[model samples]
Target chain A: MSLVVIGTVAFDAIETPFGKTDKIVGGAATYASLAASYFYDKVKIVAVVGDDFHKEDIADFKNHGIGVEGLQIKEGEKSFFWAGKYHNDMNSRDTLITELNVLADFDPIIPDSYQDCEYLMLGNLTPQVQRTTIERLKNRPKLIVMDTMNFWMDIAMDDLKQTIKLVDVLTINDSEARQLSGEYSLVKAANKILQMGPKYLIIKKGEHGALLFHEDLVFSAPALPLAEVFDPTGAGDTFAGGFIGYMAKVGTVNFNNMKNAIIFGSALASFCVEKFGTEKIRNLSSEEVSARVQQFVGLSSFVIGQ
Target chain B: MSLVVIGTVAFDAIETPFGKTDKIVGGAATYASLAASYFYDKVKIVAVVGDDFHKEDIADFKNHGIGVEGLQIKEGEKSFFWAGKYHNDMNSRDTLITELNVLADFDPIIPDSYQDCEYLMLGNLTPQVQRTTIERLKNRPKLIVMDTMNFWMDIAMDDLKQTIKLVDVLTINDSEARQLSGEYSLVKAANKILQMGPKYLIIKKGEHGALLFHEDLVFSAPALPLAEVFDPTGAGDTFAGGFIGYMAKVGTVNFNNMKNAIIFGSALASFCVEKFGTEKIRNLSSEEVSARVQQFVGLSSFVIGQ
Candidate 1:
């Protein structure tokens, strides 16, 4: 069985307080698949790129033992490009440019050999396309974790809700959770969203950390506080990737496992922010990841006397 | 021998989305001492009120087995009164009125019975007053926890810095940490603030939780996510009281104890916001507090496989 990640595979130019970078390999699928490869061996990607995409970048995926049979490269068009600059706080950013040359009319195609999908991670994408990927699969994956942004909720909420109902887990940021549920309290928001279909809801609070809600259970994971966030791009996707990757490795779909997965995901995302794009996450030793996970254990562990 | 709480013990009129309250017995010392009473038996208050202050309110302190020997009753003078209205989010508020009657040019008189203080909680008051309390003590307490706000930073930063150096622990919300340290990153902010005076610093994030920072050690405490915050008037004070009170009960000052103390403090603060003023926190049984602490343990506990 394999873990399939479907989303954009494109280029990004980013600027942060630390520095700026030229067009580097970035996208929801790229970050997610790379993160998943660290935990699970059988990882595959389903995304559309362009002729402008470098050969070495595709080889990089293979270097991590990731299958790219579903990564489509258009012959003549340029790859999707995005440019953004982060503010001083790094919490907010401004989009400078968006050249969606290949992503605009892209179609996701699942490979025939990848039909035995056990876990699926639908990275941030159009609600309609995300739904189409699910429909095209011959059999539903054991666990479907879908990540989306506020942009879709703003324009295509009805379609978003429909897709949301099909997934087992839905992940969104704090403001997006507020927008989707129309509730100020997260406890109330989680209650309302759970009724909308997903069995689990993950609210990503960026620096504060992430919270997981399943039925009446809530698990709060602490984010590794950094002296500085070098780059925030792809951190969320990295988190989603690590989460599903760990799930696939354990082959479990329960609250306890999901809680551990969040810490693993948070550790990977913590490394992702130390450098631009996926530079920090692309090369992580198993030892380094284990040590980082321990840091989280130390940051939040406490014992009370009876 | 005792935990001395020094701050206002007057009245507050609050308006929240759930409801509103008239002039209730709400103040830093009142809330702190009450919360401290739950964990530490010998809790004492040091503040000034007026003849208008109800006799039953003074009886309430005694009811909790709290000492009010240091609480001065000014004859024929009105007590300090504050009125505020919370916004929809329950995070921001607008002050409607502030009448500092007995508090103006007030003198804090420590009773001889309070000379055996072992732990001190200096609530939100003028920096000079916070410093004077420390100076007047016959012997320095084993641990001193001082809480302040942005209002003091805006007006009396110089005095604030001087007082902060004398305390063992300092607690302020996230924004105030950023303002005082001139750093956006909380990790960096905590580092700078620790250099100011206190060996440990806590940046309170309200609903998000609280962070404890020492030299190189950091601890994150999760706040119980509530369905609704009826009133947030004295939550911070209640947290401080719970923290120092737990420390006094344990009879030790260390990182491990501080972590457990924070959990206890968070539990008390969680109950403080459940109703208008102190209605919810006034009458919690030991069983309820223990159960709430366990909920926090359940909310954040997770184990990673070896």
Candidate 2:
């Protein structure tokens, strides 16, 4: 049972209040796969990069025991590059550039070895692309979690809703949930989104926290309030990675296990924002992860009767 | 051990998107004492109102098992009246009228029968009055929880700071904590505010939740995502009352008890926002309160490695 991640693996230039970074290795798959590597082995990546992508970074994937057989390398083309500036609050950002050179006409290639996929994570991408990958899978994964954004809801909502119907879980930020459901109240929004297709809906509220709603039950996970958020570029992807990674490790798709997954996901996302890009999530030890999980337990646990 | 609440007991005209009310029985002391009375049997309210205050409204406090001996009733003066309109988001409001009638020359009088104060809640009043109540107590209470707003921080900084030093716990909203500490980050803001005097700090973030910070530990409580927020006027005061009231009932002030207190506080605040002014909190059953508390448990509780 292996986990498969599909998204862009490209370059990004990020500017936060603390500082700025030049063109650095960043993408939905890079952050997601890196976070997943800490929990599960034999993780496969199905993404497209260009010649501009560094060989050392490719080696870094091997270093983390991530399978790259499906990581298609386009010949003699620029990699997808994005540039954004985070405001002082770090909650909002202004997109400065979007150079989708290699990704514009990309095709997702599922490797023969990736047929053993038991868990699938469709990161932020074009709805048609995500749908294509889902259709390409020979055997449907045990659990499929898809993360999308308001951008798709704005542009390709029909296709997005079509893709959303194929997944078991849908994860999006709070406002995106509002935009998708056209309801300001998150509970109401979750109800409407759940009706669209997904059995479970996770509403990520950035710094506020994340909420998981499965039918009538709801669970809230708090974002660890940091002294300073160095960068928030990959935090959401990291959260999604940790979630599906934990699920793959536990080998269950039940609500109880999903609760723990959220804790682990929130823990990983907390670490992701402490540094620029994927710097903080790249080198987490098992001991550090366990300790961070314990911090979440400490941060949230309370006994009422005693 | 008794719980003492001190703030205003007057009339308010509130306008919200859901609805509006004219000259309803509302005030910090009114809401706080009512919420506290549900937890602690001996709840005393020390507030001033005028003859215009309904005789039936004063009797309503007695019906809630609240002691009103210290509620000074002035002759011929109008009760304090405030009029406010909530914005679309319900997170902000515009104060249309503030008539400080009976409260203008208010002198908090501690009733001779209420000397056994073990838990004192200074509920969003003039810092001078809060400090005077502290000085008038023959024996210092075991726990003193003070609730203040940005309004006081703006008009009475020195008095606010001086009174802040005298409390065991300080409850303020998120922005108020930032305003008091001159820090944008809540973790940094909490650290600076903790240095100012209070041993424990509760930063209430309406709609998001509340955060409990004591020394090096932090716990977050999520607000129940309601379909609609009818009014948000006295929710903060009601939260503080439930917190201190639970602390008094449990007869402890430790972190574990404080965690449950926050849950209870958040639950009461949740009810407060469901109706205009103090309507929802006027009559709540123990079963309803328990069920609400259990909803908080379900909303926030998660188990790992069961």
- Model 2: per-residue lDDT, tens digit, A206-278? 7788899999989888878788988999999999999999999999799988988988998999999999998
- The C-alpha TM-scores of every prediction are 0.99, 0.98
What candidate 1 gets wrong by more than 4 Å, as runs, is none
Best by lDDT: 1
Could you tell me how far off, in angstroms, the CA of residue A179 lies in candidate 1 after the best superposition? 0.5
lDDT tens digits by residue: candidate 1, A1-306: 999999999899999988899999999999999999999999999999999999999999999999999999999999999999999999999999999998999888888988998899999999999999999889999999999999998999999999999999999999999999999899999999999999999999999999999999999999888999999999999999999999999998999999999999999999999999999998999999999999999999998878
Which structure among the candidates has the greatest TM-score?
A: 1
Worst 10 residues of 2 chain B by lDDT: B297-306
Residue range B1-306, candidate 1, lDDT tens digits: 899999999899999888888899999998999999999899999999999999999998999999999999999999999999999888999999999999997788889999999999999999898899999999999999999999999999999999999999999999999999999999999999999989999889999999999899999998888888888889999999999999999998999999999999999999999888888888999999999999999999999879
Model 1 clashing residue pairs (backbone): B165-B197
Residue A104 error, candidate 1, Å? 1.1
Candidate 1 CAPRI level: high
Candidate whose DockQ is highest: 1
